[model samples]
Target: MARYILDHSTRPDPLLAELAAETAAATGESAEMQISADQGTFLTMVTQLVAPRVAVEVGTFTGYSSVCIARGLSGGTLHCFDVSEEWTSIARRYWHKAGLADRVTLTLGPAQDTLSAFDQPIDLAFLDADKPGYPAYYELLVGKLRPGGLLMVDNTLWTGHVADPDRHDASTVRMREFNDLVAEDPRVTVVILPLADGLTMIRKNPDLS
Candidate 1:
């Protein structure tokens, strides 16, 4: 079923394919951190629809997701924040190769510090960073997200353990807490899609913005 879903979805282009291949060969086990092709396609579609002037991505691993988002921009910039210079260097190369260097910006540092300093009203944001930092990132992103802005969070399902009553592992527990936090927040509407682990979409209410 998963394979069928992917087969039907829009495929990644050559540049994206090369990025995936290089990520796996170079990063080895860490390549699992990169978003899947379907997710990348989804990001592109959402960005196109939103047509945001300022988009933000937290936890850009190897830049697959960023590339997807940047490709969808008409006149917007995608701001990527990550702690690893090594991983993002590869991403930077791909961005340049895809001719999207002008539409994307990279910031290397702790997202807590870098994101707090970002003053632009975010029209869209993607969070796939450390699980423990979700709450902090959520606060900062939601605070800066303009009214009706969209925020997408990845890997919130933790292999579906978040819904399992018997799963007591630390990561599973932590993910559950984060899910609950988003669900309970009154400022945004939340929906968790069971695509690629779990993708949660949060849209800030325009009235409250």
Candidate 2:
């Protein structure tokens, strides 16, 4: 099924393909942290649909996803937060190569600290950061999202461990809790798509008080 989906879905552009290859070669096992090609396409589609003037990405590892988001933006700005200079530095080169450097701003710091200082309303927010930080990031992102804005979260399934009764790891437990919290939240309508790990889409209610 996954192979069929990939085969049928749109492929990444040459630049993006190169970026993915470089990321894999550079990071080896850790390259698994990068978003899959299908997920990247999904992100671009969502960004194009939202046409956000301002989008925020909580995790910007190596910039593959950031490139997709930026490409979809119609003159919008993307704020990317990541703590590792070593990882994001690689992203910077690709951003430049993709001609997305102007649209993206990379912040090297704890996303928790940087996100707290964000005061402007956001049209779109993508959360691909630490599993344990999802709750806090969701709180901050939801509060900042304009009514009718979209929030997309990656890896909610945690490779299927989220539903497994025997797996009680900290990440799995936190992801389960986060999924429940979003499910019950009144501010947004949620849907969890089984794309790549698991992508959760939340749209803020337009009828805001």
Q: Which numbered prediction scores highest in lDDT against the true structure?
A: 1
Scored by Cα lDDT, where does model 2 land? 0.93
lDDT of 2 at 196: 95
lDDT per residue for candidate 1 within 100-196, as digits (tens), equals: 9999999999999999999999999999998899999999999999999999999998888999999999899999999999999999999999899
Look at candidate 1 and tell me the lDDT of residue 156. Answer: 92
> Which runs in model 1 stand beyond 4 Å of their true positions?
none
- Candidate 2: where are CA atoms >4 Å away? none
lDDT, each prediction? 0.95, 0.93
Q: Which ten residues in a row have the lowest lDDT in candidate 2?
A: 200-209
TM-score of each: 0.98, 0.97
Best by TM-score: 1
**Model 2: per-residue lDDT, tens digit, 1-209?**
99999999999989989989999999999899999999999999989999999999999989999999999999899999899999899999998998889999988898888999988899999999877788998999999999999999999988999999999987888889999999999999999999999999999999845
